[model samples]
Target: MSPRKVSLMSRILVYVLVAIAALYLLLCVALFVFQRALIYFPQPSAYATPDNVLTLPVADANLQVSVRPHDGPKALLYFGGNAEDVSQNLPSFSAAFPDQAIYLLHYRGFGGSSGSPSEEAIARDALDLFDRVYAEHPQVAVVGRSLGTGVAIRLASQRPAARLILVTPYNSLLELGIRQYPMFPVKWLLKDTFDSAKYAAHISVPTLLIAAEHDEVIPRSSTVRLYGQFIQGVASMKVIAGVGHNSISESPEYLKLIGAGL
Candidate 1:
């Protein structure tokens, strides 16, 4: 090839490389800006009525707590998944634990709650709700499912929870994000890295880690890793047979395992 032809080929290669670099930068920016949208999917309350709803006034938001009020010192405080309408569990919880009072929190922007949802904001709300509930019901059991497992574990670490239950929980959201989008730098870009393992070591109460046998969302390895974080005698794990992540609660053993923990 002539010298002029070699020079032209080099110029074309440079241009292609620049275009690829520019597109990669744009993709990273989009992921950073809209990351929260990928995490939280707020839903309306299915049972939002005067009889079932309790309004919790916080500094920046008014959170909704779906309640099954019972007159007892024994109470259950529940935190649900990102996209879950927690009110849907009221009937089942009421039937299973008839003697205990139930309080299922609706994270901000979910189930008629005001303001946006974030890790910091939800943490504050969870602390406030636990304090309020503990004032009335001294023996409070904390139960969290999926996204809420992160919330529940952290709360149990900081508060004096009588019992702790985590359902379909992951070791860390950051790790899951990295697995889902390996091309990106998830460790640096993730703002709400729910590292439940970090909080798991701090937990001292009787705890239950529930896993679905065929969970497609959270890997069994992640659940097992979290279980190992707890002290030798602090936590116990149970896997419900013939269930997926979403369908685990439908199993009869689900409530039984939770009740057994309490």
Candidate 2:
């Protein structure tokens, strides 16, 4: 080929490479800016009434808690999945633990709670909720499911929880994000990396880590890794057979296992 033709080919190749690089950078920026949107899918409460709901006043937001009030020392505080309306769990929790009080948190921006949801914001809210609940109910069990598992574990580590229960839990949201988006720089882009494993080592209370046999959202390997983080004899794990991540609670053994843990 002539030198002029070779030079033309080189120029075309450079243009293509530059365009690819520019597109990749734009994609990364988009991921970084809107990452929280991918993480939290806020849902409206199904059962929000004056009789059952309790308003928790925080620094910036007034959080809503779905409560089944029982005049006793035993209470259960629940943090639910990202998209879950925690109020939905009230009936089942009330039925299962008739003697114990139940309080399911509506994360900020979820279930009529004000302000936006973020890892730091939710963590603060969880701690506040625990403190208030503990004032009345000395024997309080902290229960978290899916995304809330991260919140529960952190709270259990810092507070004097009587019992801790995690359902469909993961080692860390950072690891999960990388697994789902391998091509992206999730570590750098993710704003709210719920690193449950970091807090797991600090937990001293009797804990139960529940895994769904066929959980599609959280890998079994992730759950096993998290289980290993807890001090030996401090935590125990149970796998509910023939159930997916969302459907595990529907199983007969679900409530039985939770009640047994408490």
Candidate 3:
């Protein structure tokens, strides 16, 4: 090839590389700007009942906690998915575990809760809720699903939850983020990395991890890894067949296993 032709090709390659780099940079910037939107999917309360709603004041925010009050020391605290309306689960939970009082938390900015959602804020609020529940009810079990699994695991590790149940749980949001955005430095960029693996080692309570056999959102390996992080014999796993991540609750076995955990 002629020297002029070689020079032209080199210039073209430089321009293409610069364009690619610019696009990647733009993508990283957008990911940084709208990262929270990608993480927390806050929704309005689906089953709003003034009588059942308990207002718990967190710092600079009033969190809506749905309570099915029962006159007993047995209580169950539930933390739900990112976009879940936990109030909707009251009837089912009440029926499943009638003996225990139920309290379902609506994460910050979710349902009627004030302020925005973050890992730090949710963890703090959950710990506070657990403490309050523990005060009234000495025997308390905790349940979490999806995003709430991270919150529940953290609380279980920090507090004395009699039992812990995680439904369709992931190892960590950081792992999920890294998998979803392989080209980006997700661990560094992610502000709310819900790393449940960090807390799993500290959880010594009887723990049950329920996995969806057909889970499309969180990889089965992630759930297995999380289960392994727990001290052997402290955590047990159940994989319900013919269910995906969202539809796992629909399975009859789901409630049965949850009840068994308690």
- Clashing residue pairs in all predictions, respectively, total 0, 0, 0
- The candidate 3 region of ten consecutive residues with least summed lDDT is 43-52
Q: Compared with the true structure, what per-residue lDDT tens digits does model 3 show for residues 1-262? A: 9999999999999999999999999999999989999988988887778878899997779999999999888999999998898988998998999999999999999889999999999999998899888999999999999999999999999998999999999999999999999999887789988899999999999999999999999999999999989998999999999999999999999999999999
Model 3: which residue pairs collide? none
Pick out the ten consecutive residues of candidate 2 with the lowest summed lDDT.
33-42
* Residue 147 of model 3, lDDT score: 96
> Which residue pairs of candidate 2 clash?
none
Report the alpha-carbon TM-score of model 3 versus the true structure: 0.96
> In model 2, what lDDT does residue 124 have?
97
**If both were scored by TM-score, which would come out higher, candidate 2 or candidate 3?**
2
Compose the digit string of candidate 1's lDDT tens values, residues 1-262: 9999999999999999999999998999999989999999999999999999999999999999999998879999999998999999999999999988999999999999999999989999999999999999999999999999999999999999999999999999998999999999999899999999999989999999999999999999999999999999999999999999999999999999988888
Error of 3 at 84 (Å): 1.1
**Which segments of candidate 3 are over 4 A away from where they belong?**
1-5
- Candidate 2, 1-262: lDDT as tens digits: 9999999999999999999999999999999998888989999999999999999999999999999999989999999998899999999999999989999999999999999999999999999999999999999999999999999999998899999999999999999999999999999899999999999999999999999999999999999999999999999999999999999999999999999999
Tell me the lDDT of candidate 3: 0.93
Candidate 1 segments exceeding 4 Å error: none
Clashing pairs in 1: none
